[model samples]
Target: MDNTDTPSSARQSLLDATEALIYAGGINATGMDAIVKASGVARKTIYRHFATKDALVAQALRERDARWMRWFSEETCRAEPGPARLLASFDALSSWFATPGFRGCAFINAAGETGDPADPIRIVAREHKASLRAFLLQLAIEAYIADADALAGAWLILIDGAISVALVTGDLQAARRAQAMARCLLPTFFAPTTKELP
Candidate 1:
């Protein structure tokens, strides 16, 4: 597909249009006609690019995951490594929560709609979440946290909770609260040394 902004290719246009519409109204609400209209691409062309609507949805989600992960990494990595980097993750999330038309997480929404665990879209969503956990684990290890796996799991829960609350209440301060909780939990889980018992 052509990469230029002027006269974007049919596939790219369809993906972009579908992603925007899905983000705004969700997959079930947005139909093929709406996608075609939004993309300014013929329905036939869209079918040519994607054999089925599910395929199109999966592809759109894949693109979103790639783009979002890249942006997330850049934002979180802007701070120095260790605890600062860990806390910076929440700052990045706060910025994202404040973005115009923020609609929580696309992957989480998709997972909710696709209840079947074996569904391709659901699989993509799972992969995206796993990637997020892995990134958090890396940060925990870098911070020299004891029980890094447990800390990463706790961090993921907090992060997910913050995003959910922020989306529900439109209060970006949720991330700050989560960060504060993380700070309080860190030293307990990451103590530099433990004394031997007699």
Candidate 2:
């Protein structure tokens, strides 16, 4: 048997193909036949791995969420620590926006595709957002921002708005604008003094 014929390989191929197609178009636009053709996996093999299309989509999204978070973290970590790192997130986003075939955020697209609140795709989308918020909250805490939770929430709004606006207007500068706003807002939360002055 060929190395690519393994169950794991087949599953991963399906997921990779599905993610690519979904990113290019949308969940509704991509069909099982397309996935089968793109992945080069037999229909029975696809069903063996995923009982349904929704199941396959959910798995693909989960994989995407993990991959995106890893990439974001790596990009953000490249900046100086503390507040600088927080602002660097925007720079990272700007780079992402500039990438070829940039088509808004995958999570946002998935959420908008499904109207059902309890849908698996919607659930994964929400989870992705929550994870991003948590990452921002961690950054806020590291920066010693007062009301870290609120700061994180504000950051989330700015990030989401910037992404949406960039997609609609094709303006990559949205990230820089959002970063400037974040910088202006950061002074409101100063790190607590740990040592008493003489």
Candidate 3:
């Protein structure tokens, strides 16, 4: 297994290892030494790709977000845009939580570990949350909510709460229940229209 093939492959290998470790434990608990050992790559190789642990963590967060977004789009968009799509997002997240090496949201976990806003990991976590809020706001606008910003905020809180509760209790049912609530909340927030019925 000569991994010294190309820069691209090496970069991917590092990211894969980083994600594995982060998923297993968390960002703070996963150190460079663990990453090197888990990756089966030399320390130099890891350093070549990332200047520091912070850099590696930031890149890993971005990589995780990208993967999650792809999965979300595929799962949530399989059906029409309505309760189905909203439920699909939660369903997908629940499925992710049920995966073999199930762990809580990496961004949330990283933020907890960093504890300081100045940390690079914390910055990445903030960006992740901001992106989710923006996404929800866009969805609310599309749904024709009178106050898109407020509705998005409310839904975002519910979504976050569901995720947190599911992780804390190790119960997927919480998310499903939350999904159902979202179905009700959506229609109530928006003005009565044909699109709102679905």
By summed lDDT, the worst window of 10 consecutive residues in model 3 runs over 189-198
Compared to the true structure, candidate 2 yields what TM-score? 0.93
lDDT to native, each model: 0.86, 0.88, 0.75
Candidate 1 lDDT, 26-89, residue by residue in tens = 9999999899888888877777778999899999999999998889889999988887888888
Q: Please report, as a residue range, the 10-residue window in candidate 2 with the lowest summed lDDT.
A: 189-198
Model 2 accuracy (lDDT, Cα): 0.88
Q: Order of all candidates by lDDT, from best down to worst?
A: 2, 1, 3
- The C-alpha stretches of model 3 lying farther than 4 A from their native spots are 192-196
Hey, what RMSD does candidate 3 come out at? 2.3
- Sorted by TM-score (best first), the order is 2, 1, 3
Q: Provide the TM-score for each candidate, comma-separated.
A: 0.91, 0.93, 0.88
Clashing pairs in 3: none
